[model samples]
Target chain A: MIPAPYLLYLGHSDDPLGIKTSRGLAHFVPASCVGEFRHDDCPLTVGMPRMTLAEGKAAGAQTLVLGIANPGGSMGASLVADALAAIRLGMHVAAGLHHRLRDEPELVRAAAEAGVRLFDVRDPPPSLPVGNGLPRAGRRLLTVGTDCSVGKMYAAIAIERGLRARGHAADFRATGQTGILIAGEGIAVDAVVADFISGAVEVLAPARHDDGWDVIEGQGSLFHPSFAGVSTGLLHGAQPHALVLCHEIDRPHLRGLPHARVPELAECIDANLRIARLTSPDARFVGVCLNTSRLPEGAAGRHCAEIAAQLGLPTTDPVRFGVAPIVEEIERCFASSTPITTVSA
Target chain B: MIPAPYLLYLGHSDDPLGIKTSRGLAHFVPASCVGEFRHDDCPLTVGMPRMTLAEGKAAGAQTLVLGIANPGGSMGASLVADALAAIRLGMHVAAGLHHRLRDEPELVRAAAEAGVRLFDVRDPPPSLPVGNGLPRAGRRLLTVGTDCSVGKMYAAIAIERGLRARGHAADFRATGQTGILIAGEGIAVDAVVADFISGAVEVLAPARHDDGWDVIEGQGSLFHPSFAGVSTGLLHGAQPHALVLCHEIDRPHLRGLPHARVPELAECIDANLRIARLTSPDARFVGVCLNTSRLPEGAAGRHCAEIAAQLGLPTTDPVRFGVAPIVEEIERCFASSTPITTVSA
Candidate 1:
């Protein structure tokens, strides 16, 4: 697990989407974020005070988090130098990229001399079990998406907070790097072995004895050819009693594939439900989460209202508005009794 | 690639299913099989003459194939000793178990000293692309299943042979260990990283100018939660114009999970077609392959006829009865015309 009180590294990234990890950590767990670090060429910021490696260490930062993503998830030479600096200062370095920090010989030697740890958030734990599809004791709500990066993690985190605020027991279950960092521990399901995709999720959110809600963060869309398998596995493993359909307000196409168009919300919902029912027979959609960052205030409100009316589900932007309506729907659907303890392996 | 003229290592396995690799090689590629090696306690045989490592090497065997599977895919101490013995005899050792031969220091040193290679068939090749989901050229037929181990690979191989016998150009694309051994080279899709499951399959079966067919051997069922992700990714990546549904005559529950019931034939067919359509828009099932090994001849015939009438598709046991009906259906559906080149990325 990555040590908290992080120095969020933006590197040379300028795109807002590239710095989502830092932004997520800053917005959700501000107390754990000590400061931001970036070069002069980088313009993106998560609205935190700036600091160098020495300054961040002095400010009680325990780790340097590489919060920016680039094409192919490669680590640049400049970034490697910065990570080396952090290692020299006796602070750990963590990254959620496909490239592992431990693979670099220079950084490995430096970290060895300084006795600092390296955390690869994308690496799954060893010896993950195959999914049994057995019924477990717990209420679960999974956030599925219309496409990748459509605010699935945001909705799950918000829903967990909302449920807790309403005197209900709940915890956010992370399935990606950003979510794992925010939750401090989780499996990057996408990086797991293909055979154990569902199995990793099964272990991440196992049988809970408290009958509380496990707000599971979903991954890629069921319609996304690149990662639909991951999404399908996560769905079956989660076996959610309630599902929150996450969608972007104005997606031109499926992410990174101009040749493929995004599937309709109804079709996506049907597919997800059909697949999810293999594990959780009573799985159903409880709400819709719209990533309305692209739309203006009035337009976002109108779109949310129209979609909610058309689909007969509570719809809202978890970032701009809130997930209270969705939490209320979840409560309405699964009241005092537990709904997933009928079958056991 | 594994060198030919293999000495199949049974490794004291008694169950027939445990020795599927040897059986598959003996049945599909008899020319490559020099002889079989087994311990005294082992009763299983693929009907090949028994030979020791020296005897097999004298018979011109170049590789020693560990053709038996044990629990957890582990290499026992006895098996390691045997592998080392084979390596000392200057025979390249190959295994498809989860435990890599390269990970065993004794085997590695022995192979290095003997100037031999260790082939881990389950190890996926590096640098596989993420699936683009583009409509590729040529016709393709993928074998989908109702559960794991329902004879998808056998059906695919049979169909490819049948298509060739009918003067059609077809190739059997392997996706598992046994199929890989038979076909000589393939990526075990299940062993690939979760994110690249579909991508690996895409690389395995690429665009062809000849408008031939790639009969891809399918993996786990869409209903089998343990491995449905691999199956789904394979399905999406294959993008077959025609699908063949595979099932066993009488199965109790989903493989390895007693609590999970197998899905009905109609539901399985509909789900597969719906998912396959994301890439191949006109994808449809052309036939059903039943594994009637458990049924009597008359009962198996009756079952196939009944299912064929009910589903309005050709249904036959690829092992008991040839896959001629399925290959005929494929020919009828995709006759003399290019059906998959309408869209390009």
Candidate 2:
């Protein structure tokens, strides 16, 4: 039987499995983690609803990772997972398929506590390798929506226009791609693929990635709140240098819903940042790229700018004044060797 | 025996079941209208996949609803269902859980072709009749979200603030005398009841629905794409002069993940507007709202301004833009008998 993921009971002495993954303790306490916990037939304790560990030695899984919601649990689990992954022990952490960031902190903390060094994973920018040396500069950005008709193609078109307005080589490169797996299409997803290719040839002039060009790629629906599967492929071989989030802003407020405005936004950023930090603290945030839409208006923009300001980066449009300023800010942020500080000043 | 819903073969004249609801008909059709037709169940023909009237009746009693899709041969069957729903002689059309407004045009045309009126039977909105009389001057607004944490409550608060800024008295009031139901604080759903007296006193001052005040209520979730009963309740019974949506704006250029924006906010509004027009053609639109956090500076404000302007309404703040402008716009739009245009102007 394969060993299922285990949840360490550090707080209470009634750990049903009698497993002690943590050091410096005989008395038990609930480990603070809320991702996937791997164990083998370990019945749940510490008042957690019992979860039946899957039986059998699955093909790719050697050690199971269980999720915990206790305080500081996430860090513990991250630490453990990181250490195991680093040592090539083949540890698999079961991340949340769908849940709020607020609900996942414990899971994150526990992972940290478990000697796993977590890392945020983000897609690499569009670029081409030049002469087998380094990435060459590519200015066009491509982001796709998770589901069809959710504005992936539309946003791509809009962003291309914004980039070209800045005199940069940018455009969508969609050609043959057709319908999305989710919802039927109002606009063809393939059109953008054609645009991406055409734009690359026209603007970038022989697209190459030898010097790390700034091409933003959209991971449509891969990281949705309720879905699983973190795209490690997009993370540039698991060493993401920067993490940026493109999400709906003031969603609650825009739709006239209820929420903690600044905090919720901050939490979203923090969640992404945490993932990045787990991967590598050396990696920092570039800036939030707000895809301007008719949805939440100024509220989301202002908040994004505030987040950027808090991150000690130059905000192109402090008031979310316009997109041109954002483009300029992104260019400026990427130009620096050191972490980007306030650009407005 | 119950007769299954049937699809008529527009030009064919053979009865597979050797029976017809209408005597002397070319072919026999089921009694019910509308049924689920899967993707693979397409390429249907007139003779093949024919329903047996007697077998269907033997299984149950009256009419049958057969669900199909947008395919070539399916139109013939659709016509049959349409015929049944239209006549109004103890006939009902069940367009089972219809979603996606883009699909509505074809659906409407299909229904019209078959001479039937499709009625969506989704759940009704959660409201209580608290006001003694409807306010004569201002209007009532309802804030609902596609899902919890989608920002329904926050939008309500912002609109409230906006109304106050515009020298209008707007407040939160439940339809009934109950407060929002919170789990863990009370028993499960079974033990749950609308605590109106206690809730009203707490959420609103005396929570009286007086004609002098414009009331906006907050609801948890509205089943989307399929804006059935819940949407209808808010649009019809709530008698909202206008609806407000606060959704997240996706910025893929700077931010990375796509599909982070929930289902298209515009799509949701479009669907609601279509449904609303059926009930209240005179109902006017105030403006569109969106959050800016996911965007860079300048983008959010400009986008909001653009949308509101394009939609033919005044820009909220463009600076301190929030739900306030939405409320203000709604008020302004409804102030006169004339409907408000898009913000483009």
Candidate 3:
């Protein structure tokens, strides 16, 4: 779990990935949202953007996590200004973004003078050799999304929790921001160089003599218009035996681009299997984790059922329900003589 | 044409994209290969490595292009030593590899002292806004490959020449080191950040009021086991109105990787279209450019005929024969209301 004292400065926006637009961060990590800072030029959104940097400190905020995953991975100028103010108020700043806050000379100097740690979640791992896509002895299950921000990380985390509940030794390997914050380590797969993406995954999920299951958080989607490259790289890199398909039932189009429609669930599954088999010849789709928050009242459970019937697979809202089905499938498939793809040719 | 004064330097290895495994450099720009340089420890190959840095300078070598694209990018220490020596000899060093020589302090200092430039072909362009993938008025024909180093640049150059002969305005857009050297300006698509790959293409092929066809040199292959990401980004980034598929008949497997076989021509074409159409809905494959240098002596022309018969498309070795067939297809398709994918749509 992530540490409590952190100001999620939305800077006049309501759509930070972890926080609910209406609830103002009530759900995910309780009491973690101490303050909501805003730029003067922008109107307040969601819960009133009333808390100042000083008030956040008074409220026991220890650090500021740039909670939003902005497109193009850059923090805009207004957010940078708010971040600087937070650093001046003696708050450690952390940004899990493509553009590093540490890269800015002024922010670097201010953070240094204020004695606050500026953590960039996307710091690339040291150079790695190309991934041979060899299978690991330990069972590795990766959660790949239908698109970015479709709850791949959340699904992986939930699946891991379910595995642990069943008295299994399970490890969660994060490949993005929120996961890194919760798990305290792992490379940002999208930020990695093109050639080294699979190599980085190989490093992240090394073969364990224990053969304990490792749930790998995936990034991007093979059908995503802009980010499919990252998706393909991660899929090919993680030569996993089982995969959890994640989707937001309400997403009509790719997150940012209107031109890119989300491929049909069947199409996405076929595309992923075709690519995944390039490395893992027998990669199997374990289950489907749907984010149904955007659906109208009472539509969540029905959406899950419809998908379950349609794909003939276990389907549920990992957050509203739980990942028990997915976990059971993984353990059963990996622990038994299930004909999983092995690394040795 | 690539500038005359630059010397081609393949350190230790005789392979630099193309040539007989033994004869280091031949066929592309005559007398441009001053000599091969090898560190004392590096055993000589492809005719004894005989050129010293001093000898290269005396042979009128104004620049040293790191001709080989090494796996995982970084040059060996011996090559860096050779580069530093050339820098000291007042020769500008240019590397087309993903590893930037500009990152090295010793070479930086040596180049500064010698007052010579360090040209990194893979340097990212000035950051640009995300591409909207709108239909541009100007016709853009991109040369995509079945694998890297399959003469995409050569095809683009040849097509541009043929288009000019037919009294049309044609421009060749280079997207790699060799093409950049030939065209004098273009981004190395592989070196670019993932988000910016398409943006760079948008910049490279901006809308022109004049109806000119921009012939773009593509990078990597969509089916390439290692660099599919680069390939995907380049294909979708260029959003070319028309595509020319470049293939080498003798590439039994993807470069470097032994198990990843090249897809069949039809499969490759379909896969590229599926990805490319995500950005440009109606993008079409105009022709094929085959590099058959590795084939038996007189078999090149016959193979081209067989492929042309099979695909029912114009096919030729643009370097050996010409790109006239490809130019004709582009003009036939795009010069009129061909129901092409519009940028604005």
Candidate 4:
């Protein structure tokens, strides 16, 4: 079992992109990976500290999360050493990297000796039956993104919180480990057995709750070269009536894969709608959820405005600006189809 | 490892549908399941005999395959008894039913005592990574169906055989156990990790074989409630340049679900094209592979003609009329784009 309130580890990284994502995960989702931020040499602009294992323990770090996600997803010699060190330091280590700490013989031996757990977020599940989501009809809202790790989960949680604040009977459906931890329960869509990928969703968002909406966390992207299939299975399985499209403005290209470019905001919107409409014909693009934290002052607002104007949908960085605009559109959609009372985020 | 040339067992049954498919697999693909056919009450028209385990051994049965597959896929008490008796006789038992023979406690105990093996065809694979098949340039042809068990694998094998007969360089990519056993090597697509469903196809039909065509066997159905996700993953993963829509003339409804009606042939064709074009833009519907095995007298020929005239595509039951018409379109599609030279079935 994973003991929460983690120690975020930003190990020595040569790659620029890996550094950005690791920092982003820590800076944005601070509550999930709390306690002391450990790094070898983080930038001055970031404002994180370089801490030793003893220093981390003094700060009450229950678990040390490997903050560095490799650029090419290659499992190498260096990453394993860092995780091994963390295990030896009497910390339950959590990693979201492609290189699983559980797979390393030395790391497993150390973890067992220390009586600590190693949580690999990317591990696919063991068994699943092929799903029948077509027959089930319940309200679900999903977040789609232009690239991986562009704040789909964060946006979903924010919208769910906003709706909940207004006293609505809405729930957030987590599709990944991080979201699952935050929400307390969810199916890891990517980890499910291939035949049961969509079935996993069917099981998660059962058709029983007719009065409330299920704000489902989405995975990957339609344009991502390595994980688009997960995106498709999720789009079909969730069968969302309304979709919030998330985009990372600073990302010029797909993460890791240099050859693949992120689809244009318009194209991403259209493609997701087309795929979702295959199963849910009434599927509509409700709003745009922007991740413009990396952009300079006044730029994030301007970017949201321009895209919102062009697409004729309300847009905002759900984290900074509040998810009221996106949540409003969803509330509007649900209001017309069903007799629902109360305003949402 | 699967032992070759199985002893086909048609257990006691009243279901006409189960009998036909069993006989068809044995008749069409004799090499995979090699020994004498066994049944308790063999009909005269079918031309097969009821044989005891001792008789089956005398006839050189290496493995006993539970030939009767229920429409609802239930493995009853009697079927388990037959399999246990076969195991005691020192024959490896193989079943394709939903009620996994390997899951039964008594069967497991009996198998251990007798030194035998059990194979469950519907078991999904261990773990799989997501696929990126969009970059591949290999010429691939997939057989999609209106519903499950509608001759997709049969059609793919026939087309590959015909292409090979005409001295064309082509290979059949298997996605299921029967096809895997037929080809002697293949990852079960349905059993693969959900995130890696499409990825499995990418590994199977890689871009290296740019010169030759890959006749890919399809699974489940885009319209089947229990398995549409498999259909979506395979379609996106295969990235086929040309797709053949397979249909059975006598299927009144989807396999087990009576509520869900089979989609019209035209609608099925359109839906598949829309889904496939998401990844492979140049993908086209090359032909219609009909399964008119149950059609009486001259009705099968008449039905083929009507569909061929309406859709304006080459249509035929690959088993009955040979896969010449379907192969003609695939060859034509390939000749214009690639340097492949040959006439095929």
Candidate 5:
């Protein structure tokens, strides 16, 4: 029944739950699970605008099956009304919710209407350049979507498929990315952190877009989720050098949340690199992007490669850990200390 | 013709423009034009969520119609493939591409689906919420629809009916404003500057669920046409108190186009209030929300009410102006003139 010509369900309470699709039960249900029907009415809260011929008699639906409730299991309005019934009725909707589709709003408008490309699920997801395009001045990853499906394209395709399996040259700058503007929370998390600072180290991913993604001009918390609007859209696009702080641990199917806790994901990547070095102190360096989905075959990626070898980033995935080995260990800690010009004043 | 059940045309180069009704195109374009057609893409591109489900099935439209030669254009990939055909076909979609539905991701997922309810073409139909039924807070001018109609619920109900006509209080805060954090570009230019800061002072509005008005985040320097995602969702959701720069001196019809001359809408509202006062320098205060439609009604709203009475907070509506008295005279020239010690921290 999910054959989809438009079937949006999105429920939690108002009722309408069962729909099944392989081509069996499509009874029509949802007017709160069928009781006397005729429900619709929300043209921006009735100031008017509800016409299209009363949504074709309350949706006799060529297949439009809207329903709602959930917004509590961590965000939902039936996923923003099945993403507004597939963006105002282009029709062909379907939903169970699935981890609140990131930030809901109709599954982030049905993953932007099923283009479902962004992967910066905030953190994790990044494995590193595993496949699909990118690499030619590469090293990118910008996924931003602070509100819509906050996954930023599943964390920039799991960190551009884990830096293309440790070879290098990642991609997703979404078209632009030269002197590294990177930016946050959308455009696929700053093209997956400018493809991991151009070298394709390990993880970056953050910054999804639509009309969003600011870099500097006054910082702006870098798209919070704790600076995961893809590293605050790459420290407001390009104030980058170091701020990689990915996190993801827990496996019984991605358990325990809070970024999967590794000391609370290194205190949320050292509190987003001290809030991106207090909002850009010329950015110093910092890295982390672990997530194996519940440890095992290699203990949370070898305990994040011994916690980035005691914070120096020797990690190239001896077992597994990324942000391109912590941006090559924060570019070898600013080539051996003395940097930190106070967040690029 | 612009009817319902399901109809989508959505175009660009090929032709066909505008027509997205949820409940009234007269029962499936009973007369008008009927299941229209056409496509070239550009609905806000990037890959447009898989080119809006392959151009909504090559414009045969399972139920989606989009157009965006440039109506408030910006989120490329053809408006994320018209937000993936209104989030994967929940349909009834139409987005000739206007600017002010607060970030239109298919009308923010059809007002967050679940018993659906969206209809905005300047609004005034559908029904429901007649009295003590809806309002819980205020500010709700929603018209969202990124892919098709990027008016994000008509700039969230024109910023909750221009902050309830200015007495303040407003409503339509999407989903509890759980995250209506605007900073720059879109989100309908920050829900029309949080509906002009709930009509120049007092505050609150921003709370409506069922999706549409809920999670409106957006942030800084987005892009051209209409993309600062509504001024970065109003500087990541009202971080303003002083900045109001405005531009559009003439050629303005915005989403409906007509003449359109954005110029970056005053440098994207001064780079989204210089990044919301550098993220939160006391959530800096800024002003200006002009759209006099090429200036008239008391000319630029009376030159923004004599510059908000030389920055003191005057102007009741010699024609309508209240950028919060020049953002309280630029928050009284910084430091010490404090007041918003914390709105969330």
Candidate 6:
């Protein structure tokens, strides 16, 4: 596991969407974030205290988290230098990029000399079994999306919190890199061998005896041609009892592919449910989590209401508003026979 | 490419199915087979002349092909010793197993000392792109299956030969180890990173200016929980104009999974066509290829006729009879405007 109290590195990124790792970490686990680091030209921040390597070390930061993602997941020469500096200061370095940190000889040497660790979060654990598609005990709610970066992770994290607050047993199961960072552990299902995509997910969220809910963070959309295979495997592996359909209301097309249009909400839900039934026959839709952050507050509320009325499912923006409606829908749909006594966290 | 004039290594295998690689090589490229090497007590053979490493080298063998697969693809000590003996004789060693010959220090040292290569057919090439799902120029036919080991590769290879004989341009694109060994080169789609399965396949069968038919070997069944993801990704990546559904008639259940039943021919055809259309809008089934080896000649013929009438599609065993019927159906369905003169291979 990556050390807590991270000094998040923003690098030279200016795009707000590109630095979602830092944003997610600060938003979800702000108590564990010590400070932020960035170049002088880097105009982005996750709203943490600015600090140098020495300053972050003095502030009790145990790890330097490279929290920015560039095109192709490549690490520039300057970013390597920054990581090296962090290593020299005896701080462990962690990144969730397609390019692995262990591949950098300089970083490897410096980290070894300084007795610090390097964590490449995108790497899957070795020797994952092929998926068996067996019925596993435990209730699961997976957040599926109409496209990538549609707030499935955020909705999952929020749903987990909401479930626990209502005296329900729940755990957030991360499936991607950013979710892995926030949850402290998860397999990057997309990086796994093609044969083991579903199997990896099966390992990630195994059978639980407590009948607790595994709030799984989903990846790409089923309609997304570039990543639909990974999405399908994860769906089948999850065998989710309940699904929360997540959609960014303003998405004109699928992410990156201009030729491929976003699938309709009904189409997305139907496809996900149909494929999910291969593993979990009782799978059903729990709610609709809309990413209405692009809309005005009044319009967002009206949009949620309209969708809720249209589909007869609870709808809300898990980030902008809250996941209370979705959580209530989950409770109503899959009410437990032996309810647990409420205990405040 | 692996060196031709291969000394096929049976490696103490007793199961006929376990020695399919050797059998495939011996069947498809008999001229390249120098001789076979196996333990004296081993009863399995691809029906080649028996020889030791020294005798095989004298017989002009350039490589020792590990043509046996044990459970979990593990390399036993005896197998390593046999491989080392070949390396010492200045011969390259090739294997399609999950375990790599390069992973054995003794084999690596011997190969390096002898200036010989170690070929791992399951390892994919680096830097594969994500599939764009854009229309590529080519007429393609993919052989999909109702379950694993249902003659997808054999059908693909046979179809390529039949198409070429009919003066149609065709190439066999392999997607598995045995097929890769037969084809001399291919990307094992299952071994690829989960996100790049389709991308690797797209690279494997790129746009052909000649409008040739790329007969891509298919992988796992869509109904099989262990590997449907690989199968789906391959179907999308191939974007075939025509699909050939391959199935074994007598199989009671999905391979290795006792709980899962094999999908019906119609269900398999429907799923493959529906998924293939995501990339190739005009994707349609041309014929069905059945593995009728388990049935008697008369029963196989009756079975083929019954299914042919029931589905209104040409059905035949590519191995038992030939792929001529399926190739004829393909020509009838997608006839080229300008016919080229047939050239004998």
Query: Is 1 or 6 the stronger prediction by DockQ?
Result: 1
| True-structure RMSD, every candidate | 4.3, 28.4, 5.2, 4.4, 26.4, 2.9
| Second chain TM-score, each model | 0.93, 0.41, 0.87, 0.87, 0.27, 0.93
Q: What is the lDDT of residue A344 in candidate 4?
A: 34
- Best-matching candidate per TM-score: 6
What DockQ, between 0 and 1, does each candidate earn? 0.64, 0.01, 0.40, 0.36, 0.01, 0.63
The single-chain TM-score for chain B of candidate 5 is 0.27
Clashes of each: 0, 183, 5, 14, 276, 0
TM-score pick, better of 2 and 4: 4
lDDT computed for candidate 2: 0.34
- Candidate that beats the other on DockQ, 2 or 4, i.e. the better one: 4
Candidate 2 lDDT over residue span B102-155, tens digit each: 244665665566554544321112321211112223456655443322334345
Candidate 6, lDDT over the whole model? 0.88
Model 3: per-residue Cα lDDT over A134-197, one tens digit each? 5567778899888778888888888887877766667899887777776768888777766666
Segments in model 1 whose C-alpha atoms lie over 4 Å from true places: A39-43, A50-61, A70-72, A76-91, A113-115, A337-345, B12-15, B39-43, B51-60, B70-72, B76-78, B88-90, B113-115, B337-345
List iRMS (one decimal) for every candidate: 1.6, 22.3, 2.2, 3.8, 16.1, 1.7
- Better-scoring candidate (lDDT), 1 or 3: 1
lDDT of 6 at A318: 83
CAPRI classification of candidate 5:
incorrect
Rank the models by lDDT, top first: 1, 6, 3, 4, 2, 5
Residue range with the least summed lDDT across 10 consecutive positions in model 1 chain A: A336-345
Pairs of residues at least 3 apart in sequence or in different chains that clash in candidate 1: none
Model 3 residue B7 CA deviation in Å: 2.1
Higher-lDDT candidate of 4 and 6? 6
The lowest-lDDT stretch of 10 consecutive residues in candidate 1 chain B is B336-345
Stretches of model 4 off by over 4 angstroms after superposition:
A12-49, A66-75, A95-106, A120-129, A134-137, A223-225, A336-345, B9-25, B31-48, B52-54, B66-84, B94-130, B208-210, B223-226, B336-345
Off by over 4 Å in 6: A39-44, A50-58, A70-72, A88-90, A342-345, B12-16, B37-44, B50-58, B70-72, B76-78, B81-90, B113-115, B342-345
Error of 4 at B333 (Å): 2.8
Off by over 4 Å in 2: A1-345, B1-138, B144-148, B174-213, B218-232, B251-261, B277-281, B314-320, B336-345
Per-residue lDDT for B1-345 in model 4, tens only?
568566777677656556544565566666565444545464422344445777876677777877666533567887888888888889888776656777898989888998888877656544344565456766788999998888888888888888777666788998876676566556667666555677788777778554678889998777665566667778888988889999988688787666657888898888788778757878898888888878864888888899999998998978778888777777677674332342231
Model 3 CA lDDT for position A77: 82
Give the Cα error of residue B152 in candidate 2, in Å: 2.7
Docking class of 1: medium
